[model samples]
Target: MIDAIKTFLVKIKDQGHVLPLIHQADIQVNLHCDQQIIQLNIKNGGILFLQNLDGQQVKYEISGSPTAMKQLFEGTERLRVLEQQGQLKASTPLRTTLLLESIFFLTKAQNS
Candidate 1:
């Protein structure tokens, strides 16, 4: 699962359209799937995936079961929809939530 997440982020990083957005933004996210936690640091025009939080301040924490996470990573589910269905939970401001949704949508489009 962590490998999949890393690969997904690598794809996003390589995307020309997404690169500009990523370069201009600094975001930190903690993804919790079941008992596993993966921290995503998006800053300085690069993305880093870490298994340990290392006391970094997190801007958002998104959590769900492994099944829910798999659905999301597979582009079979949207973050908003999963949250609405109680399959996932995200702690973030509205703006951040929208940003994440957009990122996921863009990734899905790329896969298509």
Candidate 2:
């Protein structure tokens, strides 16, 4: 999982280098497994660069405290409960719900 995150970050950095035309930013995602709290703190240093519509290259940084992380995990746990039932029946509804809940986190990270 850590490797995957590193790979994703590297890929995004490479994209920023290639484009040099879109707003890019980075934040340190401090994930506390014990508390299940995800704190995203924008750092003093980041690699993302941007060139806006006027063709002005600019630096970018992203800072956010998106509080929906806990809610997202709770929704997933609800679905997990159903999956833990004796009858292991997999259906589209279950899959869709998981997908949607996952989007809440993914989109939050991407947009931030």
Q: Which candidate number would show the highest lDDT if scored against the true structure?
A: 1
Instruction: Give the C-alpha miss distance for residue 24 in model 1, angstroms.
Output: 1.9
Candidate 1, which ten residues in sequence have the lowest lDDT sum? 103-112
Q: How displaced is residue 95 in candidate 2, in Å?
A: 27
lDDT per residue for candidate 1 within 24-103, as digits (tens), equals 66888899986778887778777777886666767689998887776676556788899999999999787777776766
Mark the 10 consecutive residues where model 2 has the least summed lDDT: 57-66
Task: Predict model 1's lDDT versus the native.
Answer: 0.75
Q: State the lDDT at 50 in candidate 2.
A: 21
Candidate 2: residue 10 lDDT (0-100): 56
Superposition error at 76 for model 2 (Å): 16
- Number of clashes in model 2? 0
Q: All candidates: CA RMSD in angstroms? A: 2.3, 14.8
List candidate 2 segments past 4 Å from native: 17-28, 33-41, 44-112
lDDT of each: 0.75, 0.32
